[model samples]
Target: MTLQTQLVLRALLRNPAHEMYGRQLADETGLMPGTTHPILLRLEQAGWVTSRKEDIDPHAEGRPARRYYRLTATGAAQAGAALAKARRPRTTALRDLAGEGGTL
Candidate 1:
């Protein structure tokens, strides 16, 4: 998966039950809306995320309806594994770099 996709997945994992809008996700991930929106669309298409239309302000003119995203079961599993892998200590590399001084 691409870095942006990974990031989006991770964010979703962090708040699996909380529906996130695209703009909020973009803000949290520090990605531009252009980049974030496409990634979200792709994830939704891939069955990793489910998107739904949210109630919009009737008073707001010309604004598009808001869509919220939530992680699918598969997505949650994948995100958990990814997070574990990312959090795993770099023992091998650290040991190699430390040479004789390192603890196995």
Candidate 2:
């Protein structure tokens, strides 16, 4: 996956049970809203994530309902595995250079 895609996945994976609005996710992932929301839409289209309109009284709150996103179990596992793989130590010559000890 692209690093940005992985970032979105990891952010959502952090709290699979918690629903987060696009703006909230953008903040948490340190990604621009443009970047974050598109990733979310892709995930939603793939059935890896789901979104809902917040169940609050917009008039009472004086604002529109926020759309909240959460990961599906399938997504959590898939993303968690990708994160784990990304975190694994490298065993290549590159690792001896830029990736590890030497400054390439």
Candidate 3:
């Protein structure tokens, strides 16, 4: 995973039960929206995350409804394992892949 992807995963892992919106996550991760949104799209595509639009009327709220993201049960487990592995020392082959931001 890229460092940006890892940051997003780590943030989600910190509070897996709490659903956070895109901008919220971007702010928390110190990443720009251009970076964070695509990472979220990929994670959702991988079945590691799920999202839903906030169930409030945008007009009444005077803002767009936020799309909240959270990790699935399997995602939480997988993310923990991935993060652990990413923290460990790697062999030459794995190090090369890591440098390229390859997936776990």
Best by lDDT: 3
Decide which is better by TM-score, 1 or 2: 2
Q: Name the Cα RMSD for model 3.
A: 6.2
Which residue pairs clash in candidate 2? none
Tens digits of per-residue lDDT, candidate 2, 4-102, equal 888888888888998899998899889999999899999999888999988899999998999999999998888888788887767685667676566
TM-score of 1: 0.71
Q: Comparing candidate 2 with candidate 3, which one achieves the higher TM-score?
A: 3
Overall local distance difference test of candidate 2: 0.87
Which candidate model has the greater lDDT, 1 or 2? 2
- TM-score list, all predictions: 0.71, 0.77, 0.85
**Residue by residue across 10-98, what tens digits does model 1's lDDT show?**
88888798899999899998889999999988878878789998787746846788789999989788777877777666877778877
Those runs of model 3 whose alpha carbons end farther than 4 Å from true positions after fitting are 93-104
What's the best-to-worst order under TM-score? Answer: 3, 2, 1
Clashing pairs in 1: none
Looking at model 3, the pairs that clash are none
Model 3 Cα lDDT, one tens digit per residue, 1-104: 78999999999999999999999999999999999999999999999999999889989999999999999999999999999988886577776876776665
